[model samples]
Target: MIDYLDLALQYGGFTSLDKVYLARKLAGLTDQQKLDFITPPPSVINAYFAEIYQKQGAEEATDYYLTLSQQLSLFPKEPSFAEEKPFVRLNLSGKAFGFAYVDGTGLAQVFAEQDVEVAENLLFEIAQIFPHYVVFEQAGKVWMKGNDFDETILMAEETEFLLTDVSVSDQFVKISGLNQEEVLQAAEKYDGQRYVAWSGRSAILYIKH
Candidate 1:
């Protein structure tokens, strides 16, 4: 197995303090979990950097983009099974879900879906092999597989919020059961602690903290 911490320090371009923090956080994870957390698809990394560059500046995004590119370059390229046929079909609660294999790049491509649980289960299974970041859409809301940093924050009346959908990747959170105006009103209460963006019926709240 690779020493992820050493690799991060040598080539990931993280500061010494940041690498130490990451090492501590990743210390308890299983080998497979470590791989999953460290090795996301190049496309996903690019998309993340693009978003950051758009919001932040090139100076702010350069280190992350370079580090991620270096990390991916160290891994051998895997074939995308998505081009072939469906990798597996899952039947849950009288619903059919199709999943296409995208190598072991932590990319979970869902061909079909019924509920959030199904999507979560499929991604979890894929993680065992690819051990990378995964994303899917559920309940008309987009969800990305995240670590503990992305926590579940329950509000009144069964309203739920997810803080940071992609772990330490960003401070964006997902808000369900809230409309644009409602989330905006709630944001005002936060006193600029967060900003709300509309995604269909769901709201993506970017947290300052």
Candidate 2:
């Protein structure tokens, strides 16, 4: 396996102290080896940098990913902690482009397509992959795959409310738990597109700003 500690220090743009702390945390590697790893030839360093940049688009993704440990605490664990841990980091590579980490909830994937035609086609393809999906409108409308349609869409608001029944307007559930400020902020940040899924649960919520 690749040495993640060395990689973080070398390419994560950490300060000198950060590098020292990272070096200390690394297992088994000698100081000389770590130095050599950092002091590679110019061409090799540039290639390494290029590869790192290619794999990770920005710091945000890395920061978000590292927060998995903290996020785990928000959820109720299974009978065993061993079984509960590694849920979020349990990424099946190439499964999806984006994923959400919910507390008691499950994981959710978000696919944002600028092209309507492409998105529509992808939506159909996604439905075929899963039996049923949740549907909601972001800045643009979206269709989910799953049986819990009411749970997902009912959470959608004209501005940001849930729709209990697609055919009827009377039945609805206002999304609770999240504070009003957070909801407003999400609406602004997502520009009206926020979908959520909880782990081990079929329920999916599609939030539209």
Candidate 3:
């Protein structure tokens, strides 16, 4: 039981004391039962927080809950396709941007540098050539929808940003520095269509269509 708690504490980043208490509580349960409790459902996490809130204070409970949530969210998601193989190198404006590959179902992954404008132009060109191929960009630490490259760049120039996901509807709220709502609004009005988001000052969104 203690060993199971140690494993759970290491795997889930739970506190040693908390895991030990949980392990002791479920001591008579089978190994599978212990495993299930350790890899708790969301409800279990919430319940744990509630218990902590009662024992500790709101601050401690909230902190623990957030930490648990962050750790859980870090669990890797199933990949959309098998490991990608680079089929070709992409060059934009005479500069080496990145590599391109056709994944499962003709979906393409474009691993590229953080040049938003160049990426947008190259993606547009790629789209014209491979209309059926869905293009995605792996830039820095963010996975982006291919079309949002330019919009993300413009947004970054105005304020701090976090590359949360590949969604275009995601807002680039003004966190600090000059609010570039006007600039972003103007860019949004442009004839071309693309989605974009930023991570701090770095552009992370890119798409080919």
Indicate which candidate wins on lDDT: 1
Model 1 agreement with the true structure over 1-209: per-residue lDDT tens digits: 67887665554445678876888778999875665555545455556666765687543544454344445342223223232321333344455544433333333344444344543334333333222233444444332332223444423333333322222223434332234445444444332233223333344444444
Candidate 3 yields a Cα-based lDDT of 0.40
lDDT scores of the candidates, listed in order: 0.43, 0.36, 0.40
Clashes of each: 1, 19, 7
Worst 10 residues of 1 by lDDT: 160-169
TM-score of each: 0.24, 0.24, 0.24
Residues 1-209 of candidate 2 have per-residue lDDT tens digits of: 45556455545445667766776655567754543344324344344434543576323332333343232232223312232222222112233222223332333333331223334334433433332334343444343323342543343344433322111113333332223333333334233344433222222233443
**Candidate 3 TM-score over all chains jointly:** 0.24
What TM value does model 2 have? 0.24
Q: How many pairs in model 3 have backbone atoms within 3 A of each other, for residues 3 or more apart or on separate chains, i.e. clashes?
A: 7
Candidate 2 lDDT score relative to the true structure: 0.36
